[model samples]
Target: MPWDLRDGEPVIDPAQVRALLREQHPDLAHMPLGEPVRGWDNTMVRLGERLALRLPRHAQAETLLDREAAWLPRLASQLAGLPSGTPHHAIPAIPTPVRTGVPRTGYPFRWAVVPWVEGTPAVHVPLEVRDAYAPNLAATLRGLHQPAPEDAPASAFRGIGLADIEDRFARRWDALAGGLGRERRDQLAEVWRRAVNAAPYAGPRVWLHGDPHPNNTVLAGVGPGPMASSPVLVDFGDLCAGDPASDLGSALLHFSPYGREAFMAAYDAGQVPDPALWARAQGWAVNYALIFAAQSPGEALRPLGRGLLA
Candidate 1:
C-alpha cells in the first residue's frame, strides 16, 4: 500500500520505494533498497550498490530537484572537460542524477536516482583538528563560483543582494540575542552591521552550492593527522547562481577558529578576496549564526549556531 502524507509528514519506507521502482523501472526493482535517510527536503535511499534514490518530502522541496538534475550534469561535465592548463580547483565528486522519475501511484512528487558517494557526514565527526580540509574546501568553492549561464535559476534569497534580506536578518538576530549572552550578541551585531555596510558584489553572478554547512560536506578516509579526513560535498538542492560570499559564509558556520583562517588562506592563494568581499562574507556568516541560534533552544542545529559565533 502507498503510505500517506499524514499531518504534513511524508511516510516513506523501503517497500514503498521499491514498489515505485518496480512500476516505473522494473529492470532493477529486485535489487535490495537501503533504509531511508530523512533530510529537511527529501528521503534518500541507497539503490543496489552504486545508486541512490531521492524523493521529496515537502511541497517546496519538490521544486528544487528538477533544477538540480538539469544543471548539475552540465556543470559536472564542464568541470571535467576543463583544459589541463585552466586554473581550477580539485572539486570533489558531485552527485548527478542518472534518471529523473515521474509521479506514479501514491507518490506525488518528482524524484531522481543518482550515483552514491562515499563518506561520513562532516557534522558527526570532530571538526576542531580538521584544519587541513579547509584549503580543499576553499579550492572547491573557487571552482564552483564560475560565471553561470544567463538562464540559470534565480534564488530569492541565496545569491541575491545581501541588503535585500536585512529585515529577515534582524528578526533572526532578535530571537538569538538572549540565548547568545550579552558579549557574544554585541559582537555578532557589529559583525552584521559591517557586512550590511560593505560594498556589494558588482561582478557577474556565479554558481553557488547555496547551503555548505557541515552536514552537507562529507568526509572520507582519515588523514595522517588527528581529526583529518578527505572531504566530499553533497546536496545540490540549494544550488543557484549568486555572490561567492553566500557560500564563503558557510566556512564560518562549519569550521573552527583556525580552520576558518586556513580556508581563507587557501582560497586567497587561488583568488584573493577583496576587503569588501571578506566583510560581506562575515555578514553572511552572522546571518546564518543568528538563524540557527534562534531555533527552539532544544533544536539540534542550536549547537552549530553557537559554534558559528565561537
Candidate 2:
C-alpha cells in the first residue's frame, strides 16, 4: 500500500466487501476479490479478470468518488466521437465504472466496478520508454481539454490560480525546508514566484485530469508499431474543470527534456504558443513536486520530486 488510513478511518476487508457485493451486486459476488491496493483516497481490489472494485477508504473520498462516477462516462463518450486512426483514437481507455454500489450499514461510501486496465504504471517505465509515448500523451490531453460545462466540478487545490493556494504552498515549503535544505528550498521558491507572477489564465475553464502524474497513467499496448504501448489515464478521483495549465504541468512529471520538447511540439501544433501558460504549467509542476515530497517523504516519488525541481 502506498498510503495510510487517516486517524478514525475504518478499515474495509475482503470479507466485508464481498458481503457488500453479494447484497448489492450478486452477479459480481462470485468473482475472486484480490488483495486491496490502497491509494491516497481509495482502495481497489481486482474483481476477477476484467473488473476492479474502487471504494473510498475514508469519508473525505466519498465526494470525489461520486464526481468520477458522474463524469467519466461523459468524457469517454466525447473521446469516442473523435475520428478513428488518429492520435485521439490511440488513447486505449478511461476507467469508466461498469457498475456502481451505494453506501450500506457498514460500508459508508459509494463504490464502483471499473474495467481493469492492463498495463504498467508509467512510474515503473524508464523515461526513455515513456518518451516514446509523449506524442500520444499530448494528443490525449488535447482531446480531453475541451471546454467544460458551466456546472462542472471544480477543485480548490487544482486548476485554480497558483496564488489562491500560495499560503498552502508556503506552509508545505516551510515544513520541508530543513529536509530539503536552503539551496533546494530557494530554487523551488523562485519557481513558485514566477508562477504566481505569470499572467492569469484568461481562457475558459477546461476539463482537467487534475492529477495526471506518471503514477496515474498506465502504458498499455493499444495497437501495432510505435503506438502499441499507449498511455491510458486513470484515477479520476481528482477530476475537475479549471485552467488547462494545471494538467499541462504534468508534462514535467511524465517526460525527459527531449520528450517534453516532443510533447510541446505536438500539443502546440495549431494554436499560438502562450508563454504565460507554459510558465504557469511549470508552477503547477512545482506545486505537485512539493506535494509528492511532502506527502510521501523518502518514497519513490521523492526522487521524482527532485527531478521535477531540477
Candidate 3:
C-alpha cells in the first residue's frame, strides 16, 4: 500500500508510515513488508508502490546523495543505457515529516523517495545464473565508461580520492589493536597507494554509480537491445565520474575468474582499458570491499568481504 500523504499527527516512527500505507494503499501496504533493509551507512524501506525510500542513516549521506544529484547528469549520455539507480530529477529528497502530534519542524535524516526497480538484489544468486548475469552487469559497466566529449558538461564534485580512503582505513584500523598485522595490511596498503598514484584518469571521464552492490542491482523485465535483458542498475547516491574501474568492486572481489572473464568479455568486447589501470582496478575492488564493510554489519556483505581479503 502506498503512503497516504495527508494532514495528521507528524509521522514520527517508520512504523507509523507503514500504518498509513495499510490504511491507504491496502493493495500495496498489505502485500508484505520485507524486513527493513539495514546498512550501518543508511536505512532503506521498500514501498509497495514500485518505489523505495532511502533515508540517509547519517549526516555524511546528505553530502553523498547531494553530490550524486549534481554529478549524474554529466554522464547522462552514457548512463541512459545502463540506468542502474541513476539519479533522476523526478525523484526528490522528500523528508518524511516527523509527526510530533502538533507537527515538528522537520523529519529524521535527509531522505529520498526513490522509484523502486523490480527484481532481486544480487546478494546470493547461484553460480549458474551468474553466467548470464555477469555479462549484463558488464555491459552496464561498459556504458558507464563510455567515452565522453572533450567539451561535455562535467561533475562539480572535487573531493577525496584513494588517499583519503587509505587514511580512513588507517585511522579506523589504528582505533583497533594490532592494526591488521604489518605484512598483510602493508600489502593492502601498498595496493591502496598504487591506486592512489594511478588516480585521475586521462581517459574520457564518465559518470559511474560509485556503489553498485548486488543489493543495488535489480532485474527489470528485458528492455531493448543487446544490454536490454540484464538487471537494470539502481541506487545512484554514490554516483561519480572517474575511471570506470572504480566501480568494479564486484568483478575483482566477488566474481569468480570465470565470472570475471565473462564480465570482462562483455565490458571490453570492443574497447580495452589501460592495463596499468586495470591492475589498479583490482586494488580498488579490494579497498572498496573493505570500505564497504564499515558501512554495514550484514551477512550479505560478508562473503564479498572475505573474498576481497583472500
Candidate 4:
C-alpha cells in the first residue's frame, strides 16, 4: 500500500517502480530493488548494486529532479576537468545520473538512476568525528563554488540577500516562540539581524549545493581519525546558483564552535576573506536551523536545529 501520501501526490510502491523500470528500462528490470527511502521531496530505492532510482514523491519535487538531471552532469564534467592534486580534485564524488527515466502512464514524473554513493550520513556520525572532516567539507564547497551561467536556476528561499527573506524569517521566528526560550530566540534574532544588515555578496553568482545541511552530507570512510573520512555532498535537488555564502553557512550545521573555526580558516585560505560573507553565512545557518526547529520539530533535525541555535 502507498504511505505518507500528500495532497495531489500519487501512491508509489516497489511494484509501481518495478513496472516503470520494466516499461522504460527493460534491461534493468530484473535487478533487485530495495525498500523505498523517502525524503521530503523524493523517494529513492536502490536498484541492484551499482545504481539507485530517484523518483519524486511530491509534485514540487518533479521539477527538482528535472533540475538535477539537467545540471549535475555539467558540474561533474567541470569537476573532472580540474587538475589532479588540486583542492577541487580532492572532492571524492558527485552523484551524477547515469540513466534517466521519463514519465509514463503510472509514473507522472521524470526520474533518474545515479551511482549509489557509499557513506554514513554526517548526521549519524559523532560531532567529534565530523570535526575531522571540516577542512574536507571546505574543499568540497570551494570546488563547487564556480561562476554559474546566467540561465542557472535561482531560488527565492535561498542564495538571496538576507534582507529579502526578512519577512519569511519573521514568520518562522514567531512560530518558534512557543518552543524556544527568550534568550535563545533573542540570540537567533540577533544573528538574523546581522546577516540582513551585512553587505550583500558582490561576487558573481556561484553554483550552490542549495541544501548542504548535515543530513545531506555523507562521510565516507573505513577507519578512525582525520585521514579516515571524506565528505561527499549529496542531494542536489535544491541545487541552484547564488551567493557562495548560502552554501558556506552549512558549516555551522556540520561543526561545533571549534570545528567552525577550522572550516573558516581553510575556506579563507582558498578564497579572499570577506567578513560580511561570513556574517551572511551565519544568518543562513540561523535560517536553516529555524526551518529544522520550526517546520519539523517532531523529526530528527529538531535537535540539530537547537544545537545550531546554541
Candidate 5:
C-alpha cells in the first residue's frame, strides 16, 4: 500500500519510501524482509539486529533532521532513552540508510537513518504504564535545557516570543473566532492577552522537544510484563529552546477541555504555560490543523483550534 489514513488523513506513500530504500541501498537487491514501520512523519523499519532504519518523511522535517544531525551527537552522551543519532543533516542531500541497505541519497525530499528504538507505541500502553514516564520525561526536558556545545542552530531555543505567539494567535482567533460572538471573542482575547502579558518564564531558555505528545513517546512492553514508559522522545525536528511555555502548549494546546484534563493528568508537576502563551501554541496548532483542514474539505476541524480559546 502506498498510503495509510491517520485521524482520517492520508499520510504518505509507502511505495515512495520503498523506492527510496531500493534506490539508495542496491546492496539489499530487493530482499523480501518486512513491512514499513509507520508513523506520522517518517517510514520506519526494524532491521534484524536491535537496529532500525528511520527515514525522514518530508522537506520540512529536513530542517528538523538537520537539527537532529547536529544535536543528537552532542546529546548522546547525556541522553539515555533514545535510538542512535540521525546519520545525516538532510534527506536526499545525504546518502544514508533506510532499512538495512536502503540508502536515502538521490531521493526527492529529505531522509535519514536512525537506529530503531525498542519500544511499543504509547497509545497501546496502559495509562498506569504511561504515567510512570512523566518524571523521566520531565528530567529529559530538564536535561535538554542544559547548554549545547555552543554550535547548535538558532532554533535550539524556541526563539518565538510571546508577541509572536500572540500575533499569530490573534490572526487565528480572527479567522476562527469570527463565528463566535464578538463579545465572547474579545473577552477571551483579553484574558488570553493578560495571561500572555503577565506570566513569567524568565529563566534562561534551553533546548526542548517543541512537542512531547504521546505520539512521539515509545513505551516498551517485554514478554508478559506491564508496559514500560521509558520514553524515547524522538522527532527532534521541532527542537527549540525559547520560553518553556512554548513546549507546554503541546499538552493542553491541542486538546479540548476534557481532553486537555486527561492529557495534563499524564504530566505530574510539569511546567504549565500561560493561557495566552498557550493561545500562541494554539496559533501553531491552527497552522497545523489548517494545513490538513484545507487539504481536503473539513472546515469544521479548523475551529478545533479554538480549543485553545480557553
Candidate 6:
C-alpha cells in the first residue's frame, strides 16, 4: 500500500541528506545541499547547481526510484536514435541520473542524484498562457511512447488497459460523485463507460511515463502567444510498457479545450492516433482525478482533477 494515504511517513531534511552523503558519498557531501522540494512521494534536495538528491518520503516510492534507476538509462539511449520526424526527437531534454545510492544510516530507502532539469511545472503556468506549451507537451508524450525493451518494468495499474482498472475506477468515481455537480458527475460516468468499452490499444507495448500530469512536465521557456515551446518530461517513477492512451491523460487534465486540440494536432502531425484512443485517455484522466481526490484531496493536483471531470 505504498500509494495509501498517510501523513506520518518519515521526513528527510537537508541535515539527514547531508549525513547520508557524508557517509556514503563524501565527494558530494561537501557540496551545498539546498532546501528540499517536497512532493507526495519524494523530497528532492538540490545538490549544488547541476544535481538533485531525490529521497522517498513514502514506502511505495522506493520501488519507483529503483524502477527509474533500472530503466531511464536504457530509455535515454534509445531516445536519441528514434525516428527523426517522431515526437521523441522533439522533446527538449530529459534528466540524467548521475549516481544511484543505496540505503544507509538514517535513510532506509534507495535514492538518486539526477541532473537538475530546468523549466516551470505546468501547474505554475497560468491558464491563459498554457495553450502555448501544449504542442511541446504532446511531442514529449509521443517521444516517450517508443517501444520499450523486453525487461522494462511492468506497472500493473498504470500503463495497462483501462479495463484492467475499471473496478477501482468505479469505486473512486462513486466516492467523488458526492461533491460534484450532477451534470458533471453524469458526464464523467458517460465518459468512463464509453472508454471502458472502447477498443483497447492493439499495438505493441510502448514506454509510458505512468504519471504525465502537469507537475511532472517542466517547460523551459514558455513565451507568450500561440508560439510552441518544447517541454522536458521528468519524474519517471511510473515508467512502464502498455497502452499509449494511458500516458496521454495529461493533455486533457492540464489544458483547455483549445490547448487539447493543439496537443492532438501536434501529436497527429507526427503519427496520428486512432480516434478511439481519446476515449481511453479520458478514462485514464478519470483514474488520475479520482486517485488524487481520494488520497490527497486538498493538493494542487485537485484543480486539474476538477478540470478532468469537467
Question: Cα RMSD (Å) per model?
Answer: 3.1, 3.1, 8.6, 2.6, 8.3, 2.9
Model 5 clash tally, residue pairs: 10
Over 172-226, each residue of candidate 3 has an lDDT whose tens digit, in order, gives 4454314356787677667766766774556656656666766666654432332
Model 4 stretches with alpha carbons more than 4 Å out: 1-3, 83-92, 177-183, 221-228
lDDT of 5 at 14: 46
lDDT of 6 by residue, 176-277 (tens): 788888998888888888888988888888888888787786766546532246556788888899888888865567788788888778777746667788
Ranking by TM-score: 1, 4, 6, 2, 3, 5
Q: How far is candidate 3 from the true structure (C-alpha RMSD, Å)?
A: 8.6
- Give the Cα lDDT of each candidate: 0.78, 0.81, 0.54, 0.81, 0.50, 0.77
Model 5 TM: 0.60
Once fitted onto the true fold, the runs of candidate 2 whose alpha carbons sit more than 4 angstroms away are 82-92, 177-189, 221-228
lDDT (10s digit) by residue, model 5, range 51-76? 44565555554556666666565555
The candidate maximizing lDDT is 4
Tens-digit per-residue lDDT, 161-189, candidate 2: 98898888788777765677678768878
lDDT agreement of model 5 with the native? 0.50
**TM-score, cand. 1 vs. native:** 0.92
Residues 1-310, model 4: lDDT tens digits: 2336777787678999899999989999999999998877888899998899998886678888888889988888876777777643354378888889988867888888988877677887778877888888887788788778899999987788888888887887777656777798787788888888899899899888998888888766554553235778889988899998888886578888898998888787755789999999999898878777765445656678778766
Clashes of 3: 11
In candidate 6, the residue pairs with backbone N, CA or C atoms under 3 Å apart (3 or more residues apart, or in different chains) clash, namely 88-143
Model 5: lowest-lDDT 10 consecutive positions: 87-96
Candidate 5, residue 278: how far the Cα is off, in Å: 9.5
lDDT of 4: 0.81
**lDDT at 14, model 4:** 93
